[model samples]
Target: MLDATTITAPIFIEDMEVGLTRHLEKIISDHDISLFAEVSEDRNPVHLNDEYAESTMFGGRIAHGMLTAALISAVIGEQLPGHGTVYLRQSMAFLAPVRPGDLVRAEVEVKSIDLRRSRVTLDTRCLVDETRVLHGEALVLAPSRG
Candidate 1:
């Protein structure tokens, strides 16, 4: 049996030297699309209307910006941060369109650590093949005994 507390131990800068990588492949299920539409209430034709999307620059429906942003959360929450890590801040740039069938892989690396403050800087990116769909930096508060 896996102990939740042990699994959630705070990861320090040195601890992250081993590095972490994760790959995600999704077919952009209808449920994910519909949920994004409902929550954001952004009826952007490019994201909601197939006909409108067909005429747009994308030539087809594309996922919302926030939907793509969620990929970052997955990287931190499930991978780097793991269970008990707390998010501090994030900065991101969207570079490419994410279509319904596109497969996005998010990569995160610990760039720097402020041990005194118990904070870490992470380099994050979401990509499809060699093209980056999203790029950003994330700051997280690492748990410490201090």
Candidate 2:
């Protein structure tokens, strides 16, 4: 069985801080790539076919970028700003490729909060072995617990 842990507690708009953060770690697998392709209909050969990927700049198959980013989503939806949070928008830049066996750590830190608007802006990033693979920001509508 896979083990998991919460890097931070659930947060609400009333309790969020500009520096609050959370994260999770997971290993990318071939099964994950296949399932993501099926659900997203992103059947790019580079993510599925080893031969095709070998001829590309990545030199081998790589996980879908969005799939890697979903780690950020998992943290947002399940940890910080927990349940009842709704994603408003996200922007990302893929800095490196994530392979099937790569272990990735997805993290998020609150950058600002608009209490009146019930929104939180967070700095998002995914890293492997201390090297950043993805970096971005997200806007989310935090739940009102009051």
- Which structure among the candidates has the greatest lDDT? 2
Candidate 2 at residue 34, lDDT? Answer: 99
lDDT tens readout by residue for model 1, 1-146: 12335554445444665244444545565567779999889778788889999999889889887888887776676657555668989999999988887777778787777777777788888887789999998898865555
What's the lDDT for candidate 1? 0.75
Clashing pairs in 1: none
Candidate 2 residues 45-81, lDDT tens each?
A: 9999999999999999999999999999988988878
**Using TM-score as the measure, which candidate wins?**
2
Kindly report which residue pairs in candidate 2 clash with one another: none
Each model's TM-score?
Answer: 0.83, 0.91
Query: Once model 2 is optimally superposed onto the true structure by TM-score, how far is the C-alpha of residue 17 displaced, in angstroms?
Result: 1.1
Q: Evaluate residue 96 in candidate 1 and report its C-alpha lDDT on the 0 to 100 scale.
A: 95
